[model samples]
Target: MISSEDHARLSQAIREAEDLTTGEIVVVVSEQASSYRSFPVLWALLAALVVPWPLIAITTLGPARIFLIQLLVALFLSIFLSFPSRRHALVPRFIKRARARETARREFLGRGLTRTRERTGVLIYVALAEHHAEIMADTGIADRVGPEVWRGIVDELTDRIREGRLTDGLVAAVRRTGAILAEHAPPRFDDVDELPNKVFVL
Candidate 1:
């Protein structure tokens, strides 16, 4: 959902952030963490079950007709809920957060953040559709910084995303993360850039 210009801005932010500390920062923005496909199906099934009851009680329709109507309702509602917006609505907030958090962890590992020379890698992940964000730090940095500090960064990024300023939020987050790492994990004279300074939009 970010434009090329915004991508450039994020890349610049990453580069600048990494300039301050030895920590390698990776930014990933995803359309969604999980498809949540089953939520729509479950909703459709529930609707169909409740709908047939009303038809059976109010109308003298035959069992065959009521069954057909139930099938039709289920089919229609399932298709309707398949839309991204509708499907997202059918999922609970906790489920969304859990999926997003899991996705962030997977991305952290998949991106080789753990393999950095000093184990000082950080992943700032944002899932737009889920309205969630997470900051994951590798062992080196995690040993020095607390989870509450990262939680504050995630909270700010989420608020900016809610305000429709995704790029701005990321830039701010990167800068803040850099400041923290500068304090806890200052760059070494022989430090080298070990990760790409680009935003991965999935």
Candidate 2:
């Protein structure tokens, strides 16, 4: 479980690692509830049924014909509402945004900022009325370092970046953290680990 203390630490780390104005960094870690993209899909399916049912029933001669028409309508609705291919001439901006968002989530997870393998995208609720800015990560980060340590790292990074000392601070923090981890838990020859040597930068 993540705590407020850890959130504060991570916020500081992020500040130190990136150059930003004061009050730019805000970290809030909390439990996440269900995400419902399916809701829109269901609504679309229902709307398709309602819109076509009357027309099909009135125009079709037999029950079988009506059923087929309904089926076709459902299929068309699903395809229409679903993400269209880039080949479509209508709206390219939406496609680009979706592609960028996917890439960002993948990158974030690859860096070890999030724990879940499920691609839920960057938004994670940390507490009541608070959220963390996960848009920076393309792939979610794993919880290799304990929450406390991770939070501390974020806090330090955030502070340094806000102070315009991002480059030096991040290098020092990564080295320091690596040394501490090495001293405490040196890897064995048989271990099959593939962790990155460098810390992720924003």
lDDT of 1 by residue, 1-202 (tens): 9999999999999999888899999999999999998988899999999887888788899989999999999999999999989999889999999999999999999998999998999999999888888999999999999999999998998888889899999999999999998888888999999999999999
Q: Can you write out model 2's per-residue Cα lDDT over 1-202, one digit (the tens) per residue?
A: 3345543455455434222211111222222221223443565567766865576656745767666666777776655655433123222444434544454455545544454222211221121111221223213222233456546664665566556554544444544444434433444444332322222332
State the RMSD for candidate 2: 14.1
The parts of candidate 2 lying over 4 Å away from their true place are 1-105, 108-145, 190-202
Task: Give all candidate RMSDs, comma-separated.
Answer: 1.3, 14.1
The TM-score obtained by model 1 is 0.94
Candidate 2 least-lDDT 10 residues? 124-133
Candidate topping lDDT: 1
